[model samples]
Target chain A: MAGGYVGKILKVDLTTKNVSTEPIDEGVAKKYLGGKGYAVYLLYQYIKEYELKGLSPKDIDPLGPENVLIFATGPGTGVPRFPSPGRYHVMALKAPLTGSIGSGNAGGKWGTSLKNSGFDGIVLEGVSDTPVYLAIVDGKAEIRDAGDLWGRNIFDTTRVLTSVVGGKNTSVTCIGPAGENLVPMAVIMNDEHRAAGRAGLGAIMGSKKLKAIVVSGDQKVSVANPEEFKDVADRCLDALKKNPVTGEGLPTYGTAVLVNIINNVGALPYKNWQTGVNPDAESISGETLSEKYLIRKNMCWACTIGCGRVTNVKSGPFQILASEGPEYESIWALGSSTGVKDLDAVVKANHYCDELGLDTISSGSTIAAAMELNEKGYIPEEDLQGLDLKFGNASAMVEAVWRTAYKVGFGKYLALGSKKLCESYGHAELSMSVKGLEMPAYDPRAVKGIGLNYATSNRGGCHVTGYTIAPEVAGIPEKLDPLATEGKALWVKIFQDFTSTVNSTINCLFDTFALGAKDYGELLSAVTGWDISEDEILKIGERIYNLERVIINRLGFDGKDDTLPTRLLKEPMPEGPAKGQVADLEKMKEEYYKLRGWVNGIPTPGKLRELEIEV
Target chain B: MVMPIVNVSAKILLFATLRDKYGVRELEVKCDGTVRNLLENAAKTLNKGFLARIYDISRNKVREDIIFTINGRNIKDIKGEIGIKDGDRVAIFPPLAGG
Candidate 1:
């Protein structure tokens, strides 16, 4: 067994109530590493099997029993002193919202506990006639009836399951009312509030009738070259501690630190991206959150940079005794984008999303789109059922969150996400989405590279896949002209490919702000006893990215789907420092396609062969 | 003929650690029409340590880690030659980002 790998995979077929185990393939581990990379390979193999049976990848229903869901971690995960190794990646054959290859990564104790419980990953297949949950304790796995646990919110579900499983390191990952109701924007939450929060994979679990997965154990991840691993880890840790981003800024303000910086740069999308600046930004910024609501800082297991905010609203209608975050994206999604400046209401709404097991980005972005639709008078007033679905109506915004979770009233449309919701209301152009998934807080109109990244991201309008903001806005590694398109395609491609590799390592993306590709190569080589190089690391990442693209292609997406919303391309930003600026996507995109060796989003045969991807 | 060095006031916006350290979000200062002049004047008004914190005394230039922008344009984009005008928003942030 290689260092950091648990050597076995747990497979459960809910339909037949069968539990099986498989040994980790050494060749696959070598090529794909683990986590997202390994899982993508597995999903592609499953798609090939479907093809053999004469079923097209497009025929696979996202919410159907045919879709496969995977929970995977990398060779770096769970190892002691591995920087932020407390995260895991989840992938499904398709996402209910995007219909592209479903992917989400989350941080907390769950991933680490699973590895400690003697498994490298878990593969969930088929559907159950009754509600069930998987429990893995020590080295044994079992499927137990979850009849009593269904329909509970995420908090209660996690609490009940943890007590039932009773172990020193037990952790639970599960869906809630939103998932049980099969809300298309539902998320799978673990460790109380940490979420695999995009692409609605929770609904996939809901469709499978699986409620939760409980894991607990005391197994320590073995390190192959302890002396060299320690030396490399110590050097990386020093770098992380020395870097201002990973060391001080994040520790002081949490992720919401970007709220003000991005706003100042005139890239903070507001009121459904009608503009790029929010005048009331300070009230919801990281500095304000630290000043007013914070109880203390929180962190994932084995994480050194404690960026998580433990907070409370103290005394208000939106008051809560305890909560975790309305991180930068959450604050923007629920607060600025919807024009709700009330931090209390934003916190309350964010908490509701956590409890109800919802993706904060999609949930809030969908509501923002609806707000536009309502303001334009396109939505029938009767459909609202007296709810004021207007921008800046903080109270109504808070009410909309729970309604969407339960799929009640107007939330029925909101549950379909922004793309479908806007299209259903005769105003598809108002949706501020790309490839059916809602984009994050960054306005591509203000930052040219992020716009290109949004259009070309494998999992739809995602920032984390390739956060060009680091270079374009926050100026990590280096600074670039936010409005300039020159050389942005190459930057976006490198960031995207590098991010793919980082996700497979299954650690916090924040680590990359301090550690570079060479550091990762050294760390992995030391841990796995493989002489990995920086070039090889990037190559593996490119292979994983291309394979994911292949899966999406089979699912009926191509170059045409690689696009931004019409508003970003045509409707120039109206105000702020970036006034009159629009995302010049075409120039950058043409160069991007050429650099990628892709023709209209599909990878060429030569490119695939170069990456060692089996066609 | 020589042009008079007229001092113009610019709005200074600070964020993250800079804000916490200085205990102010925005300020105004007069400078002789350049980003460097504006920063230098603002540093005097902010505190003695402000200049020391953002400038590399040995290199005799603004520290590489400091993110200085004029009206949302990074100073690096302009090769540090961007001239500041009256009421221009000059925001200074330390190395910081989160997704």
Candidate 2:
């Protein structure tokens, strides 16, 4: 086994109550690395197992017992002094909402604790007959009854589990009422506020009658060459500390700092992307949040760049004594998307998302779609139950959050996610989602590369998958015209492939602001004792991306599904710096398919073989 | 026959750490229609640190990391001989990113 691996995977069968361990395959580790990449490999293997039992990929329901869910860590994850090593990736065979590949990544202490508990990952198969939770301590594991803990919100569930599983390095990753209710946009929250916050995978956990997973241990993650690892890690840390984005801008105002910068570029989606500019953007800017609400900055385990906001809304209708965030995505989704410029309300809505275990992006976008539906008279007034459901109604937006979590009255509709909610109301185009997952803050209509990325992302409508915004908007590494179509296809493909590797390594994407593929190659080689070159790192990423694309293809998604919303493709941005600009998707998609050696979005068999993928 | 030099007034927008450091969101400055002139003119009322960060006195050029956009278009796109017109909005930000 390579260094930085626990060399074991804990396999739990909830239906049969069978607990066992599986050895990590070194060859698999070489190709996939771990986290999203390896978890997808495990998911694919499970899919093949199911196929032998007469279950087809398209027939596997996301909420069914057969849906494989895995929590995985990478070689970089939990390695001491690895820059932003706190992140982990979770995967499911299918996502309830997207019906595509299920995936999400998060940062907190839970991933580190899981690594310390003597496992590189956990494979959950079969559904429990009753509500239960998993407990792993010092290399031992068991399933415990969680009937009493099933109905609790994330905070209460986490608090109770932490005390019950008391010991050094204990942490809990669990579902809240939203997941328990089987809401499609439910999030799996860990370490209180950090979330694997997309694809409704939490509902997969909920469907399995699992409430939480508590991990506790003091195992040290060992590296093959400690001296060389330390040397590379120290240099990477210095780069991160010196880089303005990671060292200063992020630490000072958190991710919310992008509010002004994005809005300035006119790519900040506003009011359900009807316009690129928000007239009252500054009122909810990061500057205002830091000035009025921030208590202090927080960090994930071993994170040098503490972008997490520890905030408080002391006295307001939306008063919350303590909260973790409304990161840039959350702020835009909950703030401007719904046309709510009130910072307090955004903060309050954000708090509800964390406590209730709801994905703020999908939740806010759903509400924004609902608001549009209501204003257009597509939704009858009586269905609202007097909730108003209007754009810019801060109080109503806040009310919508808990309602969605608990699936109360109108929230039942809201909980359906924007894709379903808008479709049910005869306005599917209003969803602002691609492949059933809502996009984040960046307006794809204004930025061409992000648009192409969103249309083709393995996971629907994700910005982090490619994060072309780095070059298109922030001028990182190099600057590109956000509105330009030329060369963006290459940029999107490279960013997507590179991001796949990073997600596999499973560190914070912010590290890329300072470090690049070369830096990651050095770090991986030193820790894993592999002669990983920069080119090889990218090859690994391309393999993972192509493999994910193949998995989604088996689920019945095709080139037809790879597209931006019609509004983005047809409607030009009405006002702002990017006025009259529309996403020229087809031009870029053509080039992208050629670059990936894909035919109409499906990878060619030759391409798969070249990447050493057998499918 | 020499043409009369007309001063162009532009709105200088600051973001991220630059906004926090400068203590103002936007500044109205009159310059001779050049980005360098606009920054130099804005530097008169602003503190020395502001000028030092965005411009190098020795090199007499905008700092490499400073992202300067005139009317929402990057200065790099327009290349050399870029001009800042009257009523233009010039956004200045230190290199920063988050998703």
Candidate 3:
């Protein structure tokens, strides 16, 4: 039990109503680090054990009682000194959406609270007989009845849980009705607005009949070598404050700042990826949001860069009381992707998604796909239940948010996500997704490196998994031609491996723009007293990434699955700076496979041996 | 004999806080020089503090915080000495970060 971790993992089996605690092996901790990495390792172990018992991968159901959910925190998490220390934890599970490993990280007080409650992680197994919420306080755990809180939205559920739990310091992470209803697009909301918002992790919670987890404690998280840790932590904080992206840009405009920039560059995927640019994109840009809607700025717990937006819309058709964000992804998903130019409507939809416990990206993308279907006469007017689910129909878009959350009429199909919705119509190619998860805002046709990243990402079409956009679009470390596939494979592999480490450390990936791998290594070493080198830290990242890839491979995904939709590959971007461009995936995927020591997107045996992964 | 100087009309585009401060999305500046010279000319329209924000006053180079892209390519890759031709688009943005 060193400085960085509580050194204990809480295991709860709801089917048997049995709970246990196990000591974290120092060797495993050193190799995998924590957060997503730890979760992936644990999942691999679980699956291997199950296989030994004669259970096949095909027999495993993502939403079934056998699926495991891990909420993990890194060594630097909850440490006030680390840069962007507000990032508390990441949740990992076999996603109901992609049916592979699904991981989502959230920044809020909940993670710090979990650490203070004296556990580095929590493993939830089996299915509860009825709706219940887990309450963990100062190392003690309880599976309490949540029958009354079962059907409530995230806002109401949090309120009820806070009052019922009766501790002012208590923080809650819970699912809303969308999760309870088993919507594959459901998200887990923590502290009301922050979400573990991708890959249908919330549906897994719902399937277990788990409503929420409330935690609070007064225990102190102490770092090893306090003096050295303080020095390193201070340097990190100063670097974050001085860095332009973290200090000035993020605080000033929030992430929506990218809307105008991306749009100007012809990379803001619009109207279901039909085009890469939207003329009215400025209507939902960060500038517009800050000018007309931003009430104030908010920050995650212990974060210096307050990039979070607190917005309100008053005296309009899109009037909302107040909400935390309609971040860049949400804006692009609900606004540009659907061709709804009204900022108010997008904001209202964002609020609805947060309250309803839905991943706005998937939900909005699903709706946008349906809108295209409706526009093309594939979905009849009667099929939409008299609602005009047409592109740019702001009113209908807002209504669709509620109906989708409730899974009513056509909303039920929308709740199934864009991939399923499109497949249901016999046009699966129309769904802009990689492996079953809906794609985010950035058009792959415009950014070749990002296209490769999307195709190769282990968790479906996630952007943050690699984020080649930093070099491709923003010129963070250096700028690369967005249209060039040359050397992009090398960059993607480097970024993916590095990102895996960052995600596992459970720190915000935004910190990477400011701090280098050495900075992260220093922080971890100072906190954990592990004496880890930067090279070793990067190797840990590679190991974690390879482990996840192997798990997905075992789940039947291969090079064929590591691909973009036909639209990105075959259809050209009709207008904008990237006109006539398509993702040159074949060229890049080959380089990527070679560089990662992967054959046909599966990690090679030699690569696994090099990473020291047994399976 | 002096060589004939061909002036280039470079469109300058600003984003985010830069846009809010500059009060304009884009402006056209005609100059017969390199990208650095064009930036210097554009700086004439901005206050000294704002100018300093986009350039390293000590290093006499484009500030790392300011991303300057000429023709959709980062000037850092092309370098400031890269010649600018007429009708070239130069985009200036503060460090923009988001998912």
Candidate 4:
């Protein structure tokens, strides 16, 4: 409690309706830090304390009450790099969709506000007897009935809650009807557009009958040494302002700047890579999005990089008049992957998914698979309620979004994710995914280290797990050949550990991309009073990563489970700069195993000791 | 005997700090070899330590924290070996902060 954490972790047991808050020792906080770091520690604590046992016919679902939803924030959050402060990534029960621990970062202010409310994290346990939302402001907290708002989508629910509670500044993280209905791809939405949108953690939240987490904190966050932190932070911010991406390009175009670049690099996986790169990429370019549909831009509290876009569609055949993002990931999934290059169409699809609180990345990916199936005549138009579902059909793209969000007809299967949909279509290999989570925009074969990250991530295929992308694809700090398989395994491993550590600290990743790891240690030291070396910071990452690995492996993902979707390995890039190339997974995996110090892909004893991660 | 290799004209978009860091965005530079040559030439103009921040560090892992997107692919993908072509947009980004 005397260290990085706010000193306490809150646990809500819905089965017994007992609310208890425990103080994590200073020792654990110092070792684990907060946000994602504490999340892993909390996962171990929750699992060790409450393990689900043998099931029964009456068991209903096997994941059971022992599976807790741990939402955590870090100490350096809200102090610098500003924005709701702190990271709010999730660690959920192994979802049926992907069968891995789905933890994703959600922008907006919930994580920062949660910490501001006097607790480092919130662990929702058991299942509630009825529908409710946990409402917390400053240090005051309560679980209020959400019966009236039960069927409401994200937009209406947030509006109602905002009025009922009397504030615009109050940040609300809520699930949509999809989550309320336990759709596997449902996502938790916050600040209207930002979602902790992977692995169906939202479905877990919905199953608990917890609709939203409303938080507003006016209190200032306390750092171990504010003056020292302020100096470093101020210098960092000034330097950031002087740089280009964080300083100019990102602020100017947001992440959409990648729309043109990735498109040109032939990195964008279009229409399931039935075609590798779109010829009419300009239609979906950031310049086009900004010129035609760009409306207003917004930033998360304290975030200096305003990479978030809010836009409006003045006229379209779509119902989505307004929406939040077509963040680089969503743009890829809903746009090129579906063969719909029209930016307006992408925005409309994004709006639909967000309003329903569905995960845009997964939702878009699964629908694209459906469209691919439809194009191949695997399913008919009647299967889509008369919607002419075909790749490149904007109308069908729009329809698929509504159908999946509302779970109408074929949309029901699509909601389960592309992995299952592909299997149903008799082509499970077409899904372009590793774990149940849909792949981000970057093509793995084109970026070697990203492929390694996707294969080894405890959550199955995930970019955030390692983001070897920084080195593998986007030469942010260094250059590497996208076509090369050498040295990538080790690259993915350290990054996974480092990123997990960053997530634990609860800071926005956009910060670390521009700065050094020592600066991170410094910022962290000023918050917790703990002297941590870069090696120690990296070790903390290994600790959380292994902790998550233990959870997912315990839930079924193990050495055998860490694999790329067959599509990535067997299918060569049909066209573009990466044409004729497929991920050389055999060499890559072997190299990765060696770098990880894992014996035949199983974490070695020395490696376990190095991370201090308990098996 | 020495023969001349074909030269390609490239356009790069430099903004704000970099505009000041590098005096010109549209310059006709002839490259007979690799992008590394271009980067080295640009490095000569920048303040000491600035170029090192964007390339692999002394301790190595790559200090090129700056985004040097080739066609939009982070040069990390193609390496510095990507041959330049006429009309290619080779944009280099420094650090940034407005959110």
lDDT per prediction? 0.91, 0.91, 0.87, 0.72
lDDT of 3: 0.87
Task: List DockQ, one per candidate, in order.
Answer: 0.77, 0.74, 0.58, 0.22
Measured by C-alpha RMSD in angstroms, how accurate is candidate 3?
2.3
Estimate, for each residue in A1-615, the C-alpha lDDT of model 2 and write its tens digit: 899799999999999999999999999999999999999898888777877989899999899988889999999999989999998899998999999988999999998999999899999999998999999999999999999998998999999999999988999999999998999999999999999989898899989989999999998888989999989999999999999899998999898988887888788888888888888889998889999999999999999999999999999699999999889999999999999999999999999999999999999999999998998899987788888988999999999999999999899999999999999988999999999999999888778899999999988999998999999988888989888899999999999999999999979999999999999999999999999999998999999999999999988888998899988889989988788888899989999999999998899999999999987
Deviation in Å, model 3, residue A418 alpha carbon: 0.7
Regions more than 4 Å wrong, model 3:
A88-93, B1-11, B28-64, B70-89
Candidate 3 chain A weakest ten by summed lDDT: A84-93
Q: Write the per-residue lDDT of candidate 1 for residues A423-504, one digit (tens) a residue.
A: 9988999998888889999999888999999999888999998999998887788888888899999999988888888989
Sort the predicted structures by lDDT, highest score first: 2, 1, 3, 4
Which has the better TM-score: candidate 1, or candidate 3? 1
Off by over 4 Å in 4: A50-63, A80-86, A166-169, A319-321, A380-382, B1-99
Question: What tens-digit string does per-residue lDDT give for candidate 4 at A1-615?
Answer: 444456777788878778778886676677777777777776666555444444321222423565678887777666654322545877765564676665778778777777766777788888887889887766667888999989899988887876676432477789998898788888888877888887788888888888988876665567777787778677778766766666777776777666655665566778886655787666876666766777788788777877777788887576456677677778888888898877778888889888898887788888888888877878756666777777788877877887887788877878768888888778877787776678777777666667778878777667777776565545556666767788877777778888887887777677666765777787777777778787788877877777676666556556776677777788888876677778777787887777777754567778778777765
List TM-scores for all candidates, in order: 0.98, 0.98, 0.96, 0.87
Decreasing DockQ order of the candidates: 1, 2, 3, 4
Model 1: residues with Cα > 4 Å off, grouped in runs: B1-6, B57-60
- The lowest-lDDT stretch of 10 consecutive residues in candidate 1 chain B is B73-82
Better of 3 and 4 by DockQ: 3
Query: Model 2 Cα displacement at A55 (Å)?
Result: 1.4
